[model samples]
Target: MHVPDGFINAPVSVAAGAVAATAVAVSLRGARRELDERTAPLAGLVAAFIFAVQMLNFPVAAGTSGHLLGGALAAILVGPYTGVLCVSVVLLMQGILFADGGLTALGVNITNMAVVTVVVAYAVFRGLLRLLPAGRRSVTVAAFAGALLSVPGAAVMFTLFYALGGTTDVPIGKVFTAMTGVHVLIGVGEAVITAATVGAVIAVRPDLVHGARGLAVPLKLRVDGRLVDAPAAPAAPVPAAARSTRPLWISGLVTALVLAGFVSYYASSSPDGLEKVAADQGIDAKAREHAAADSPLADYSVKDVSDARLSGGLAGIIGVGGTVVVGTGVFWAVRRRRADDLTAAATAAPSAH
Candidate 1:
């Protein structure tokens, strides 16, 4: 949910911003391990894909809709640290360029939408995978369950945040019930999207899936007297260029363009889960104006464009292009920074070096 400005007070907003800053700082360091040549390329695509998928708000109830939160999918496809960066990139682009989420509430949105979902989803996913069979199918199954649960996890966190710093005096219990109930259905959609997407990618190129690494079960052989562990297969060769390739990423980006540029105009014209709940509970009374409400890109349409199809199509293309450029820049900078740090470290080494 893109929490607007007035939902939470100044103190809560500032506190959440600080938390987001700290988390991003930590993720920058952690991303080095997760963002090698292979994962870094996919990371940018993941961000772009999340942005595109979010544009298509699927109907969940009669008057409400929901879309991918994307934290779990990003984390599972890449890694947790890069996943954080990926969601943050999407949030940043949406806020600054599209005005989809509020600037003042950026920190809260990141913490709740990016951090909470990835952490919760990955933890549950890893646990489930551990308990299940170690196969591609099992991975897909675990991904489905993980995506199913992560949405409710985020709703719980959001409810807690509102309970703590809510601007209005609403019933805490009722809010929790409403948020969790709607999001549970939303989670089912998330699960299906996640499982199907992951399964498809792994089927094509399991090597590209960061979570699928090291999934090959070891070989067993019969020895002279008894069964014995066979030597592991030789580590596959890493084509210097192939390591960074991302066919799934290219496919995903193309699909995102098609969906957003052409398909999003037809998406349900209904309030999303959060908006519906807020309106029903009278919690939206305090909703503040977006800081960039006047931006040409706000409301997902181009300025002075009379044709509905033309305006919306241009907006979607702008959004998709902008998100891809911004996301790629952010991730590339992160990767460059890592490489620079390593080079400096290598240079600083003394006689042993």
Candidate 2:
């Protein structure tokens, strides 16, 4: 859930900001191991996808709806560190352009939604992968379970934050119960989406899936009444320039556009889990106005675009546009920085006279 301003006091927000900053720093370093030329471009696509899917809010309880938190999906498809960056970029775009999340509470939102979800989900995913059978099925199962757990993980994190800095006087126990219970239902939806998406990718290009990297376990063959694993074959080299990125990139971008531009218009207008709880528990009374409320792109409507379809279409286009620009910029910079370090190491080698 996107936390708006004023839900947490300034002191707590500052502390949350510090925590978020440290988390981002750690993720950046972790990403150096996660990212590569092939996967770097997918980072932006992942963010755009997350942004689009999040618009399709499905109804959960009577008046509450929930959308994709996207941490597990991103981590399973790409990597955990990059997953954090993906969702963070989406949140940034929404905060500045959609008036969705609060500017002052940006740190809190990033920490709760991006950092906590990605870290916890990936941790659980790795743990499960170790205990499960090593195969594509195992990867998919782990991804599903990770997605299911990540949503409640975020809810618990938010509950902990509220306990520290909630503006309302609601009972902490009640808040925990409501947040965790509703989020678990939301987590089911998250699991289905993550599994389906990860499975689809694994089918097409298992090589590209980071979580499925070591899935090529040799099949066992029985010969002369003895069982033996087949000898491993060396991978055929793929030319760097021949990498088929355009098709997946174009298809993903097209899907993201359609979802945000058209499908989102029909999404339920009911308040999401966080909003519902805030209202029910009297925590929303302190909700503050978004700083970008006056932006032309705010509220997912384009200024001077009268047709609902056209206005929303433009907003969605801008969102995808902004997300890609920001995400790619961030990832490319990180990638290049990594490259620069490698070059520096090569150059600093001892010279043989």
Candidate 3:
């Protein structure tokens, strides 16, 4: 959920900002182990894809809608650390460029939507994988379950944050009940989107999917009437063309463009789960205007564009483009630093010897 300004007080908001900052710092370090040549670029595309899919809000209830939170999907496709960064990037872009989330409440939004969602979803996903059958289908199933729970997890976190710093004096129980109830319905949409996306990626390039890695069960051999683990097969040399991620990357980028640029026009126009809950519970009584409200691309529309379709389409395209560029730059930089560290260690080892 994109927590707007005035919903949380200055003290709690600042505290949440510190928490978000620490989480991002930790993720940057953890991502060094997660991002590599094959996965780094895909991580960027994942962020863009999440940004695009989030635009296509689906109806959850009569007047409430929901969209992909991307935590479970990203974590399953990439890794949890990188997934947090991906959602954070999308939130930042939306807040600054689209005026969708408030700048002042950026920390609160990041904590709830990025850190909490990623942590909770990935934990559930990994736990389920341990108990479920080892296969591509299991990955998809776990993704669905993780994504389903992540939405309500975020709702609970937001409720706690509001309970501490809410500007209005609304009943805490009411807020929690309404937030969790609606988000559970919203979670179904999240689960479907996550499972489908994870399944599709696993089908095409299971190698690229972090959560799908090591899914092949080792073969067993019976020797002298005793069963024992068979010798591992030597990895096959991949063809250069087959090793190229270009095809998948290009196809994914195209799909994101289609969804954001055109398909988003058909998405439900109703308020999302958080917005509906806030309005109903008087949580927005003190909500302040977004600082970027005056931006040309504010509210997901181009300034002075009369055609709703064209303006929204352009804004969506711009958002996807900007997110990809920024996200790729960030990920590539992280990858390069990791490579540099390895090279430095190798060089120092020779001198030590």
Winner on lDDT between 1 and 2 is 2
TM-score of each candidate structure, all chains considered together: 0.94, 0.95, 0.97
Tell me the deviation in Å of residue 266 in model 2: 1.3
Clash pairs detected, candidate 1: none
**Shift in Å, residue 208, candidate 2:** 1.4
In the predicted model 3, the residue pairs found to clash are none
lDDT of 2 by residue, 151-268 (tens): 9999998998899999889899999999999999999988888899889888877877888887666778999999899877788998764477767888889998999988988888
Report the lDDT of model 1 for residue 244.
48
Scanning candidate 2 in windows of ten residues, the lowest lDDT window is 344-353
lDDT of 3 by residue, 1-353 (tens): 78889999999999999999999999999999999998999999999999999999999999989998898888888899999999999999999999988888999988998898899899999999999999998999999999999999999999999989999999999999999999999999999999999999888889999998899998989999998999998999989977889999999999999999999999999999999999998999999999988999998999999999999999999999999999999999999999999999999998996
Candidate 3: where are CA atoms >4 Å away?
221-228
Worst 10 residues of 3 by lDDT: 69-78
What are the runs in model 1 whose C-alpha is more than 4 Å off? 223-226, 232-246
Q: Give lDDT tens digits, candidate 1, residues 117-149.
A: 899888888998889878999889888998899
- lDDT agreement with native, every candidate: 0.86, 0.88, 0.93
* Superposed Cα RMSD, model 3: 1.3
Best by lDDT: 3
Which regions of candidate 2 deviate over 4 angstroms? 234-242, 351-353
